[model samples]
Structure formats: structure tokens, C-alpha cells
Target: MIEASLPALNRRRFLWGAGAGAVTAAALLPGAARADGHAETVGAVMDGMVRDHNFQGVVALGRGGRIRTARAVGMAQIAQGIPMRTDTPLGIASISKRLTAVAVMRLVEQGALSLDARITTWLPDYRADVGARLTLRRLLSNSSGAPNPFRAAVAAEPALLQPPWIDTGEAVRRFATGDLVFEPGARFDYVLSNWILVLAIIETVTGQPYREAMRALVLDPLRMRHTTPVAPSEAMSYRTVSPPVEWINPRPPFLAAAGGYYSTAADLLRFAHGVYDTDFLSPTSRTALTTVEVASDSYALGGRMRTVAIGGAEVRAAWETGNTNGYRSVLGHRLDGRGAVVILNNNAISQRTMDAFAEALLRADAGVA
Candidate 1:
């Protein structure tokens, strides 16, 4: 979910200072919190963010294969003042990119696509020089150096900042005229156009709209019923800045596979269950999906990955964030299957706050001090 700001806040990261560091290990670890009362500590932290920061929405913490804390702290909902729930659907900004990325890699694992193949193999009419140098791997890793049309447009025509989500194919074709910033794979360039081309590839290979293909490949298989292109009943959108009120009902279909999807915390967890399960992806596929690329965003095939020092151990984790319009969201999981946290906030919460939430949960699993 690309936020209203096109260029700024380009990648996903948890703000480390602030309240994030205040989370006591006792409040998060299994003994004090998880055993005696799981929701109390984490839920209190959520409340603090709502009280202090602009955190409005719900969070669901899962461990031992079940949801431990499904809590909502604040709300400025426009939906008849309905409260936030675990099922409340909200925009997950660029987090949607991972969904598209996983879908493409799934096809690759199925032998229906090739990661090393030039993007033009599927998009023959694409500008030859540009396409020749662009591979699915580079595109997925955001190192393809594709020109960033969204950023350029945001700079030239501020009015286009909230431009409608047009057809993915059209966006891919139009952006094809753009020049590459560097030779493919030469640097870590996180460009949104890379996924535009990936969307086009999904259509070319699957002969289906990227939307439908995503449903079949990722959502349906995982039974992510709440994850949809259409917004849910209480599904709210917003922007807390100038000339802006509290709520919005944005329909950004043109964002397509890039950042156009509604998802609930539970549904996102179900997605995690699927993506992390070997049955959902082969061993080799999971490695490719989670292996960090050399430079860009610590991005793997679709989302980003990093190792966090928790307690006394290094834990591998996969995480993604969405910040389009007023909604801010985050989802993360440990590779060792310790824990996962999903937050879908309709009100714009700071990335640091969400980071704090996830950090507390992950640290709890490892008995952090």
C-alpha cells in the first residue's frame, strides 16, 4: 500500500526508538504475559499506542498455532461507529506486493514460469533493450532498476499522487517507455514498476487477470476469505493530514497487484500459515522466497526479510507493511515458527509503533530480557 507520499517512506521498517523500546520483556514473554494472561500486556501496549500515537484499528497475535491476542484499541471508523475487530478489513499498502510476488514465484516453482528469464519472454512487445536486461528475479527483488513512474508522476504532477489504479497491463506498457536507472541486478532499486511488469507476466502466463490469478494462487488456497479486491463492510480508509478529515472510502483498483487489497489480521495470519507451510511451497521454493537479496530493502522474492536479535538468539523473520491513504498495517513471522503479529490499522499508526508491537510479540516467544 503506497501511502499518499510517493517518494518518502519507500520501504518497510519498524521504528526502533520511542515506545518500542519500552516494551518490557516481562510483559511479552510467555510466563508473565502469555501464560498468566496473554492479551493483557500486548493489549495494554496497543492501548498506549492508541492513546499516544494515532493507532486506530486491530491487532492479532498468534502463537502455538492459535490466536492469543486479538485486540483493537482505537477507532475513528466511518462505518456507523462500528468497532475494530480481528476481521476488520483494511488496506495493507505495499504489503500487497508480497502477495503478488508469492503468486509469481509459485508459478515459477510449478515450472510455469522462470525466475532467470527476461521479463520480455512473457512480455515480448516490451521495449527490447529494457526487457532484455530485466529478469523476474531482479524484478521480484526490486533490483531491476526499473524507472519509478509513481515517484516521477508524484514529483511532476502532485495531482497524480492519488491517481486511480489503472489496469496493470496498461501501467506496465506505459512504464516500459521509462529508462532504467542501472544495469539490472547492479544495485538494489526498489521500484513499483517491477511489480507492474510482474502483474503483466502473471496475465501472460496464466491467461487470467492478475487479480483472479492471485486469488487462485494465494488467497483461495490459503482460505483467506477476507482477503479480497473489494473492501469489506467496515473496511475504512483515511489520511490524517492537511485538508483531510478523519475517514475516506478509497477504491484504488488501479493499484491492482501493487497495493490494492483488503485484508483482516486473521486472514493475513492464515496467509502466513500458508506461506510458511512447506505444503504451500516446496522446500526449494521457500528458500527462494525467503532468501534475502544482496541489497534492496532486505527484500526476498516478494516481501522483506531480516534477522533480529531476540533474547540471546538471532531469529530470521519475514515481514511486510502497508501504508496507503490513512491505513497502516504490518505482518511478521519468525522463520523458526516462534510467533507472528498482524496489525491492520485504519488510522495511520507510525511504523515504529507497529514495529514495537511486532517486536514485543517476537521477543516474547524467545523469552527476551
Candidate 2:
């Protein structure tokens, strides 16, 4: 239910950092909030996991409101031999969706738009008719019926990996004026165009570009210093990097509102804390962020998940996945905020493994593991 084609990014030179880890028994456990508790064991466990998967990147664990453990495995820039570290920046693909959703909700809170109102009321430049009836709610919940934008772009332009000289603008254009595969609120298609449009709404109502508005509304508020949108000219794109094992080259800026943000595991944990704690939005907006507006097994605002297997058991948890360029990430937290996990990878091999890790953490917190 979660498969999608990835975009291309030119493999370039990169930098790396030292690795560290935290063990289950370390003093750095979430309860202690001490950075010293589990660093060694966590580093070893994560490094072993990375080697086992033949994946390169960094992994960090944040629990009890502090970064208890962080480790970078493999070289960040193979050419330069840079090791991964807790502060190493990595692209977080779809995880960007949650931030975008938060930006849109901020607008909703400001009365710039209504979730139930037709999006056409906000975006008059688009060419779709059903769009006139599509609501911000439908788009946020994946109920908007636009088909996947990359497929159409690939259909028109074969080499989508290169510079946007042709493919980039065309892809955004096809989506900007594309047909709706299903009426708003009919069924779930998990297309990439929905949040792109939501971004347009944020820009329209707030009179700021999506990147700037996102920074102001989400990142800045959460103090996510390492997180930023992927722009075409960003130096990170040219930094030689490893390939993601599961998925590859999920474009950053091209898929901006849907996917396309970078951050460290520490940064993501802070973002999760803000989401669960509502440090950025009001009480009403916070309720709206987690409200299950759609019927999918997993998918909310920018995150996706209904249930997860943890500690040899199924647990209810909300989560998000990201894959782009040479980076991948996972962010999940229990609704109660007692448990949350962030895994950022330079390759795609960590999704399932991170899920297992998250489950274990949940079990430990739930006293079931």
C-alpha cells in the first residue's frame, strides 16, 4: 500500500562523522534524559544493524525529552571519508508531509481557509473542475483523487533524474493542472500532488513561499535547526552520497510538499515532541492534526500508520517514512507522547528495522516487552 516510484539525484561527493550508540540498559535511557547513559551500546547496536543491512548513514535515539544516544555508521561523503554523527544532516522524504500538513493547519487556524471549504476557493489558478469542490480536508487526508504526479511526468519526459531543464517544471505543471482520478473524498490513492496543492494554498493565503512559510510555521517554532527544504541548488545535492537500499532518489524540492525535507534524528525528535505536545499550534489545531479524517489503515496529515507490530505484538502508533536522494528517515510516536522514535538513514534499508526498533521501544514503555 506504500510503494511509489522514486526520483533521481546525481550521486556526488559527501562528508562523514563518527558513530555512537545506546544500549537498552544504558544510563542514557529515555527516563534519564542524559546524553551519556546509552551512547556506547546504542552506537554498537545501530552500527551492527547498518552493517547487517549493508546500509550507510546515521541513527540516533531520543527518549524522555533528550537525545539519549546517537551514532553515525559508514561515511557521509565517501570521497572525503566523513563519518555519520547525531548532527549529520540527511534528507527525510515523506516525513516532510507532516510539516506541510502543519503549515496548512496553521492557515486553517488563522482563518485563511477552512478544511471543509473547496480548495478552488483558495487556488483559482488551477485548471481542474472537481478541484472547485475539493476541500482542504480531502487533500490532507489523501481523499483528493489526483493520480501520482511522477508517473505522468515520466510518461512525458523519460529522463526525470537530470536537471529540471525539462522534467521538473513539467512534472509540477502536470500536477498543477492534472485531472482528478477520483472525486474528493471518494477513496484513497496516496498520490503526491495533494500536498503540493496544499502548499499552494499556504502560499496563497499567507503570501509566502512554501519554503519560507514552512520554516516560519513549523521548523522555526519547533527549533528544528537542521531541517530544511531541498532546493535545486543546495550543496548537499552535489555531495557524493550512498544509495538507499529500499528506495532511491526520491526528489527533494521537486516533491516538496509531499516529500522533501532534511534533518537529523535529534531534530526529528524535537519535531515529534512539538507535534505530540502541541508546542506550536493551539489546542484546537492540535486536536485537528491527529484527527483521523480519512479511512485509510494509516495516513494522517503528513504522517501515515494505523497499527504496528511491537514486541511480538501489534500496537497502535502514528508514524511517517521518508526516502530521497541518498537519505531515508522514520518518525513515529505513541499518541500519548510517552514513546517516540526517529531513524535517519543514508540508505533505504532501515524502514522495517526502524519499525522493529520503534515497536521494542513502545513495548518497553508499555511494560510489555
| Model 2 lowest lDDT segment of ten | 1-10
lDDT of 2 at 323: 62
TM-score of 2: 0.78
Clash-forming residue pairs, model 1: 1-93, 1-94, 15-352, 165-254, 165-255, 166-254, 238-326
- Residue-level lDDT of model 2, residues 1-369, one tens digit each, is 001111122232211223343323344454444333333334434444544555455555555445654544455544354555557777777888888888887878888889888777877656657667777878888888865666667678666655543332344566645667877777876777776677777877888767788888888878887787653122232223344222335353546787777777777888877777656777877777776767654566667764756557565666888765556677877666666777776644556776665555445444443
Residue 266 lDDT in candidate 2 = 76
**lDDT per model, in order?**
0.69, 0.63
Best by lDDT: 1
Give the Cα-based TM-score of candidate 1 against the true structure: 0.83
Residue lDDT tens for model 1, 1-369: 212322232231222111211223333344543554444444445545544665557666775435555655434354355555555678887788888888987898889899998877988889998888889888888888898877666578654435565566567765644788888878786667887788888989999887789989999988888788776666566565223356654544545677878887767877776788547888887888888885446878778887777877888888887777777888888778877888777756677777776776666544453
Error of 1 at 294 (Å): 3.3
RMSD of each: 8.1, 7.4
